[model samples]
Target: MQLKGKRVLITGGTRGIGRCMIQELIDQGVSHIGIIARDKKSLKELSEGYPEVKFIRIAGDVANIDILREAAARIEDKWGYLDVLINNAGIVSAGPTEELLDEDIYDQVAVNYTAILLLTKYCIPLLKNAEESAILNISSGLGLIGMPFYSVYGSTKAAVRQFSDSMRRELAPFNISVTCSFPTATDTDMMQKFEGVEMDTPEYVAKKSIEGLVNKELHVIFGGEQRIKDVEMNFSDPKKFDAQVAKTYDQFKQSSEGHKAM
Candidate 1:
């Protein structure tokens, strides 16, 4: 589970927590990284910023199946195997589900859920080729506790959590570990629209998540003790959780208004 000398592939590694993770990986001694991001300029900048690291930059949208396939194919041709796969790219468009745009919903699903599934499918062979490998999936706190005004985003993240669990067991025989991270209200470009709220720094979240992957931990959950208590209450006493949600319904709706990052 050591990151030293590992060949890692990550999505959206050019910005926010993903970018911080790239730094964490380098700090942990990873030298070869394959990054999938939408901006060609950012990818180029990343390569330039870390001259010592060998970066395989694939500039394109993760939502595209072709882009995902291309990334896997490129990695196979160049590295033959992959030691780690980090599914970190994500998009969010929030509001009341009834008022949300259809296109935005589709985009969120394609980017956050389908891309993870397809990219992981394509990389399994490459991962198996390695002596030992690992997968880290970035989910959300909302995934654990289904909150209002974020149905689609939360569902996609919840899917990631499920996929991580299933893959952890399915890939056990192959010596591939799977880790899922649930981060809440992170202070990143993704949450720029929200103001006056306490949040976890992206650096802290990235550091912890990378540590979780290296330690082979199954889950790296943010949001502290309260989040855990809420998750427990949501699962064991749905009606009780509903009443809590009802209390903050207005705040949730207002925060979600025009909150989007894609």
Candidate 2:
């Protein structure tokens, strides 16, 4: 969808890819941009920087259905409708499944999957009102191929990918496009926590996302083309894919440790 003068709502817009996308949308002449994030201080700072843009900063946890409902109400009250909804809030916790805490698993699922489900349900009415609407879901290469130590995170993203696909079919009658963006390691704070991982910049991912929206692409894979190919190849054999991912995870962990020593 053309972003010019569109009303967009981005969740988790405090930092990383969300922040980059918000700025990019503004640069594209999107006038009404609503950002939902837990960091009030950072939202305040962002509002101060872009005083001309219509920056609606609602500080709340996306995991809470009540908070999401409230945010949707505010959006409907302010703009009446939204042209784009970017579900970018996500969290990753690494550990062996046996050792992974239940709370961590729940939090990851809540923020990454459940929250998106709730937000989309609430926003569908608003999106239906727009002349052309789009739902952009931030998934990952891991969503297709499960990586060891990141199984929980990967599973959540996998759900997002499938959810977006289903929603796309369901919302097609309304002309509300759904774009599932599968990005490889991006140079955001999340990737920084992994240290030596090679990653694309948030700007790069944001650009690809915007391009996908403009072209009305249903699926977008950014960063490593090889990784996307691998995902496609493994779609038929998940067990084999998991084994390969385990090997890659070991190598990545070793590289991260080596970098830390330097």
Candidate 3:
């Protein structure tokens, strides 16, 4: 669907991909934009930067039911319909699943998986009113192939990918498109927590996402050509893929141990 004059709502719109997409959408002439995030300061900053554009800023955590419901109510009250819903808010808690705290698992699942599900359900009514609408779920490359040291985080993202698949098929009758993005390490705060990995810029990921949406691509892989090839290979040969991942994990472990010794 064309973004010009479209009403869009993006969760976690203060930073990273969400923030970049907000700016991109404005540049493309979206008529109404709503931002749901926890940072009032960032929202104010954006609002100031784009003084002529009116962005509905609802400051709250997307994981909370009350906050989500209130945001939904405000959106419905203001525009009565949304042309795009971007489920871009997610939390990643890396490290071994065995060492994961209960809170880590719960919070990751809440923000990454549950929040998207709830927000999508809440906005379906409003979405139905639009001429042609879209829902974009930002998953991760880890979701496509599980690796060592990130089991909990990977599981949550995997859930998101699966949900997007099912939701896309279910919502097809309503003329609403659902697109799931599988991006590799992105240069966001979340990636900062994971040391020594190459990352993609949020702007690049946001641009690719919009391009995929416009093209109606079901699965938008945002990790350049090599990662895309790896994903395809994993899908084509599960046993060989698992062995390769195991070998890589062993090398990473040895490297970490050597660093600690130093």
Candidate 4:
């Protein structure tokens, strides 16, 4: 779908990939862009920088269905229709599943999966009003393959992948495209939480996201060969994929410790 003059809403737009996407949308001639984030200071800064772009900042937890519905109401009030809904808000908690707490699992599922679902549910009506509309869900490569120390996080992303697929088929008749983006570790503050891990920059993801949106691509797998290999391995053998991931996790753990020491 053409982004020019499109009314776009992006969750978690205060920083990282979401922030990059907002700038990219502006570059693509999007005149109205609404950003939902919890940081008022960052929202104020963004509003100051891009005064021409319609920047609406809603500060609240995306996990709260009521909050999301309220945000949707506000969007409906400001703009009668939404051309794009970018479900970019997500969170990660890494640790062995056996050692992971209930809160960790709950937080990841709530933020990564539940929030996206709820937001999409509320935005569908607004999207239906537009001539062309799309929903872009930000998943992860780990979603396709279970990774050690990231069981909860991976599970949530996997759920998003499946949800996107089903929603795409359901929304096809309405011409509202559904796209799922799977980017490998990205160079954001989230990546800093994991030491010594080579990650793609948010700029890379932002560019790919724009490309995918323009092309109306159903699925996007970023991070090049490694990401492709992960998909291949998972399709080849689930058990083998898990075993390989376990081995890689050991190496990553060791590297993380070394980096912490230095």
Candidate 5:
């Protein structure tokens, strides 16, 4: 859908891909935008930085249902219709699943999965009212294949992938498009804990996201060469895929053992 003068709402709009998406939307002539994130100050900064646009900042943790519902209500009250809903907020708790903190598990599921579902549920009417509308879900490449030390994150993204697929079919009759993005490891604060992993800049993801949405592409997979390889491996050979994942686990175990020895 063309972004000119579109009413767009993006979760986690302060940083990473969300920030870049906001900028890209501005470039595409989006006038009214709503941002949902945890920090009020950051929201203010973004709003001030974009004086040419109308930015509505609803500051709250997306993991809280009340907070998300409140934000949705504000959007409904203000515009009464939504042209785009970008479900981009997510958290990552990398490492062995058993070793993850209890709070981490809860936050991952709530912020990444549940929040998106409920927010979409709340915004469906607004979306349907628009002449042309779309919902963009930010998933991950890891969601396409189970990987070592990223089980929880991967699972949540996988859920998003499935959700997007189902929503696409369901919303087809309503003329609402659903697009899911599967970006590889992106150079965001979320990926900072990983010591030596190469990542795509958030700019790349932002560019691809807008392009995919305009084209109404079903899935936008970033990370050129490695992304293609991963998709091919998983789709073509399940045994090889499993073995590759097993090797990654072995390497991670060896690394942990060496760290303990040191």
Candidate 6:
């Protein structure tokens, strides 16, 4: 649907791809946005940067159920309807699963999966109240193809992909749509730990992802043709895909060393 004058609620909209998506929403004429993030100061700066827009800043960690509840309540109390809900907040803790810290694993699941479920659950009514509504979930390329060291991160994203599909079908009768985007090694704060990896710009990813939502596209898969082929290979030829992954197992392990962006 067209974004002009639409009201949106997004998580972690103050930094990384989420930040760029906020800018994209503004460019598409969205005037009212509700943002949930941990940094109150960053939320204030975001509002100042975009004086023409109305921002409902809920500064708290999305992993907190209370914060998710607060966001939906505030939106209903103010706007009464929502045109878009962007589940853009995510965290990654990489490395071999057995070697990973317990807290990091729990945090990844909480921030990357539980938040989406809780926030989306809370916003369903507001979405149905609108003339048309859409949900944009940001998954990862790793979610499409399992990798060695990114088990937790990939699982959370894969859950997002599955949730998007389920929600799309469930909300079809209500004139609501869901779009899931799979971005690979995006150049964002989440990728800061990687030493050397060619990545997609957060700006480009944000633009395409938003376009997918507006156009009602089912899936916005990044990483070009190779990523598509990899996904196909993993699904069609598990043994072959395993062999290919085995060849680069060491590389993934090395790159993911101490990777934490929570």
Candidate achieving the largest lDDT: 1
Candidate 2 residue pairs that clash = none
Model 2 is weakest, by summed lDDT over 10 consecutive residues, at 253-262
For candidate 5, lDDT tens digit of each residue in 1-262? 7899999999998999999999999999999999999889999999999888987789998888898888789988899999999999988877666887788788888988999999999999999989999999999987887777777778999999999999999999999999999998788877665555677899989999988987899999887877689789899997898887777776665433311100
lDDT of 3 at 156: 84
Clashing pairs in 3: none
Candidate RMSDs in order: 0.7, 3.1, 3.5, 2.8, 3.4, 0.7
Better candidate number, 2 or 4, judged by TM-score: 4
**Candidate 4: C-alpha RMSD after superposition:** 2.8
RMSD over all Cα atoms, model 1 = 0.7
Report the C-alpha lDDT of model 6 over 50-119, residue by residue, as the tens digit.
9899999999999999999999999999999999999999998888889999999999999999999999
lDDT by residue (tens digit), candidate 3, 133-178: 9999999988988777667777888999999999999999999999
Model 1: how far is 216 from its true place, Å? 0.6
The Cα local distance difference test for each model comes to: 0.94, 0.84, 0.83, 0.84, 0.87, 0.94
Question: Following a full C-alpha superposition, what root-mean-square deviation does model 5 have from the true structure?
Answer: 3.4
State in Å the error of residue 171, model 5.
0.2
Q: 37, model 2: CA deviation in Å? A: 0.6
Instruction: Record all residue pairs in model 5 with backbone atoms less than 3 Å apart, i.e. clashing.
Output: none
TM-score between candidate 5 and the true structure = 0.93
lDDT of 5: 0.87
Which candidate would rank higher by lDDT, 1 or 2?
1
Return the lDDT, model 4, position 190. Answer: 70
Which residue pairs come into collision in candidate 1? none
Q: What overall lDDT, based on C-alpha atoms, would model 1 receive against the true structure?
A: 0.94
Better of 2 and 5 by lDDT: 5
lDDT score at residue 247, model 5, on the 0-100 scale: 71
